[model samples]
Target: MAFASVPNGNNIRNEDKVNEFLQNKSKSMAKVYLYMGIGLLVTALVSLGVGALFAGLFSNFNRVDTAYIAENALVAYITTMVISFIVLLVDGVVIARRAYSSKRSLWVPYIIYAVTMGVFLSTFLIAGIDFYTIGEAFGISGLAFFAMALIGYKSKANLNVLGMVASGFLFCLLIGSLFWGIFYLISPTLVYIFDIVASFAIMAFIMVMVAVDTYNIKRILANGCEGNVVLYCAFIMYSDFIAVFIRILYLLSALKDK
Candidate 1:
């Protein structure tokens, strides 16, 4: 019995087409970071605004009870951290679903970005933290982030290998920070030493990841992977920015206490 033979040419041609499309898409994906960078700027501005508002409130009140301020600070920190975490989870789910179903990512991350800034601002406002030091923190984070991103996007070197190491270090830092805090050993010098190192490492890692992901997004777009790529890209970008901000805050707070 003669079996019907299908020409493999069609399959081969289809794949070539897909590959070509992905190549073009990768270029497009790279441009998304431009928007992502803008989002970071927006977040920073909002955060600063929040800090300013809090500073003004506390400065005008002129109630300089260190104990009262510290207690309020603790509450603010706890509240913001809790709320930011919840927002992150919710945003992740929403973005993930869209990314999986469609190639186009959504802009829901912008909302998360805004809310995260708000939380941080609230922490300072409620705690009566020093805005001048907070401003220093914001500046440090922003500069480092931009520098790393520029290097990552421009450099010919591949940074994919660093992600694993960076993540491991970050995990250790988290554990150490928690344990040390429990023991009331979270001093300025210790924080400065640990945070400066950790922030540098994370900044490098995030740059590499952002570059790699940007390339991936471009490829997906070229392949006509359309639906939620925007959202996914935004989500990833915001997460990186948040990581940078947190590290900056740690370092800044440490310095201020000194």
Candidate 2:
């Protein structure tokens, strides 16, 4: 989504004036990290709950053996995707409405959605997914997140052009991955290749997004377009962070299988 314009007209008439933009940009970035933390916490709690639920459901009968466990795990994973998509749709609508009506309040739904994602991630965590793999995923993703946010906040380079290009690549990557996963069944070999490629590309994209989004936030503030720019920045940060985290998880899990 494009940054909201100020009533005065142009967003950032002077992008070179770092002093004028620093304070607000810092605040906006801070808000983003806050939301990221909250989202992570909610995800952990919810995912553990989901795991406990599944474990309980499966423990009752010898008739339901490991095959049943495997089947249930697959079903649960699919269920998570559907739920996440639906929630994301709702989040988009909420964000749009807030953008028009009450922009500052947009963070509310965002936090809720973050919690929902926590639940989604927990699914894999609970299914006997390796803790080391999860830790590695978070480690790589966290570093990536900070690096991107830092570059976006500190760098003077116009990442906007790179952002657009990276976005296109990311979209294509997703489509290609889906097709490969479904058609070729994404064998372990294929999964590894895709995971490595996706991690590198996504890391690049996330860095670009951080720069572009940070620039946009500064522009919004510079233009005097108030009302929760913090929330908007937070949203962007959370999205980048989560994507990186998930991608890292995918890469690590594929490697673990080998």
Candidate 3:
């Protein structure tokens, strides 16, 4: 994705301005990545701790009594997911009002969101995915994220148009999935297929979002926007990274089961 127009009408002919712009962009991007990394670390640690604490619940169930385990686990997972969703809503609100909110208020919701997500993600351990495979998926997700961010940073392409299109498509996908969930009992196999397709589609959408969001961040910085907006930017990128990681994990788990 390449655009012919230079952002902010930057004078590429002026050597000093060009250097200054590059330096500032680098510093801004570094902060974005640093915050994102911290968020990821927090999520990973909390997830691991939760998984360890609930190891007994996730293990040693007899195949003969599988029905009981499945029933209880499903209920627990669904409850956790609902709570996580609420946390996400609150987190979004915090991000939206971040400029006006105190630093403590902003940090509280962000931390809560990360911790809630970690608890939710620990449900994956119940699926019996080995640690090695889980680590591999994380590695792949990191590489994919880095590659997309680099492209977004270096590419001259305008992503505004693409972002709008992708957002619409994503909305449709969410609607379709909701309907699928409601009607899945009618055709479990077909719904499963759709779920797989939806997972991959979501992965692609989020990957594009990562690039678009990164480009937008750079554009904001280029325009001389300042303050604690970097926190909001990191939240956006961290969400993208987690989405991609979970999708890749789902794909890998599916393949492993096969």
Candidate 4:
């Protein structure tokens, strides 16, 4: 008589593990996206409300018709911005890292950072960038973000190498762009070229990072990272989205000029 084959115990256990991972995957992603979405909302509201007041006060300086006035104001503005950027970078890095250490850190510091960033973004009005262009860039950014994020989440390839390389490139690009930007008054023509190049470079870097970050977040959840780490991941994705959004804004501004 032929005996019925028994189910392999190891295979059954492995199958169960996969099902558990798939089930928990949705919940993990929901938590991350929820935090990121709220952060974006806060930033948007802050930028819009604060931007209006800033635009009115600085309207005379940003008038493109008067080269002398605009260039002078822009030089000073760039210098101030460089300083602000440094402070924001340092503060954001310091606070964001703490999310791993303290649960309370996931809330207040992140909000403060988002609000401050919004205030910084509002200063873009001094460059004569309109809300329409901002909105258009934001729309493009959202689309790109979702596409890359989806690809990253579904992909099985390890993106750790790409993430590391992209981080280095981003740091170098930041320094190069800021250094070049500070000289805009001296050579507007050259600055335009550098701006175009930098915009494209930054956009490419941000795209790769978005995919890498998304993949890593899913992988981390699979390995069972703590709840607070989920907030940190959201903060990272929030930063990636902002980077892409700001780069899109730059490209839009450049195209509009032409």
Candidate 5:
């Protein structure tokens, strides 16, 4: 009597399908990183160009006059921030709906967002922050981002809970900061101290958000997402990275002043 052979064909086919899925997920993740890097580069270049142009224009002014110019620059910066915030809100809706049929449609909003961010960030230069402090802040931010991103990629534990906690904390922090700003004239010292503490807290929150966002992007790709999804993921990560960097720079500048 001949024993019946075990059927291994189905097992092999299933293994092949799993491998293919993994390969596609990896490619998608790589694309997300690429887009994020490009977005950052664009922001950096625009910021540098704008900063240099303003610096040249202000080079001939006296100290007191320069202070006046700086005050005006701060107003412009705040206005840019408000406009950028509104643009970001609209962009989020568009990305969620995948409203862009062509690549240009997607790119226009992304580029606008990056340029606005750069214009806002150029205010730091007008504020007279030295190059050394800015460089150190960038370095620290880069290391923190990479470390958190690696942990997010390697860990098996679910990060959804962490993401929720971060969101709650951020909401509270923003509300507190708003109140502090309103009462800042009443107690400048207390408000300044609170601002310092808030800066550190915000940096930590954004770093965790970077990890959470990375994990979410990986999850989305593994679930077979494609098309403009990569742009959306890149935009989220880029925003987180920039926020962390700015907070770090602010904290460093505060410490340096002391």
Candidate 6:
């Protein structure tokens, strides 16, 4: 008599373990994204609040007293930007160096980073980027972030090389900026061309870094890191998103000027 083949019980158990791990992984990823969203919301609120405060310094939003503020406004604006930028740098260092000690330790620096970054980013308005263009750039940034993140999540190919690529681009941008200033002294037209190329390079760098960060997030969980590490991953994602938003906003402003 011929025997009927049946599924092995051990194989069935292994499949069940795989499914359970996938479910847990999904939940963990959701939590990390939730943290990212919260950080972004904090940044948005701080940005709008600081922007209004700055406008109020000029009198009121309904009727900005251009004449009243003309003389002192530039000085105050530059001062605020300078101060916030310093705080931002300090907070970034704290997050990178100390926040990894524990879950509780991360919150203060994370929130401070969000707030300072908001204050710093709002200075763009003082430089004349309008809310409408900001909104447009934000929408585009959201789309690009989601698409790149999805690609990173689905891709089986290792993206570790992207980190090196991003670093090389960053070094080039720094060197390019130094040349930009020097070339500007010689030719204003050359500076303008540098501005365009540098913008494109920065945008490219941000996209690659975003992919690397997203892939890193997956690796973090796969390697059995604790929950705090997941939140740290969220912080990394938040930075990537904000970086892309800034570059996109700048590009939009540049295009509008053109």
Could you give candidate 6's per-residue lDDT for residues 20-110 as a string of tens digits? 8887778878877898998999998888887776766655334555655644755677787898889888877777775346635677778
lDDT of each: 0.62, 0.70, 0.78, 0.81, 0.79, 0.81
- Candidate 3 lDDT (Cα, 0 to 1): 0.78
The global Cα lDDT (0 to 1) of model 5 is 0.79
Highest TM-score scorer: 6
| TM-score, prediction 1 | 0.58
- Using all chains and alpha carbons, the TM-scores for the candidates as numbered come to 0.58, 0.70, 0.76, 0.74, 0.79, 0.84
Q: Per-residue lDDT tens digits of candidate 1, residues 1-258?
A: 999988699898999988887665655555566666666666667666766655554453456654576556556656767878788678667767767564443665556655575555555544555767667766776677667656555555555556566677777867776665544464666765665676666656665565565444444454554446654665566667667666667656666767
Q: Per model, how many backbone clashes are there?
A: 15, 3, 1, 0, 0, 0
| Candidate 2 TM-score to native | 0.70
Order of candidate numbers by TM-score, starting with the best: 6, 5, 3, 4, 2, 1
Error of 5 at 245 (Å): 0.7
Quote the lDDT for 47 in model 1. Answer: 65
Give per-residue CA lDDT, model 5, range 100-176, as digits (tens).
34454466778777877777787788779988898999999899998998878776788879988988988998888
* RMSD per model, one decimal: 8.9, 9.3, 7.4, 6.3, 4.8, 3.4
lDDT by residue (tens digit), candidate 2, 87-197 = 978986776567545525776787678767766676676667777778888888788777766776666777688788989999999988776655446366777677678
Candidate 4 lDDT trough over 10 residues, lowest sum = 53-62
- Model 2: weakest 10-residue lDDT segment is 7-16
Candidate 5: Cα lDDT at 173: 83
Task: After superposing candidate 2 on the true structure, give the runs of residues whose Cα lies further than 4 Å from its correct spot.
Answer: 1-21, 61-84, 168-199, 223-227
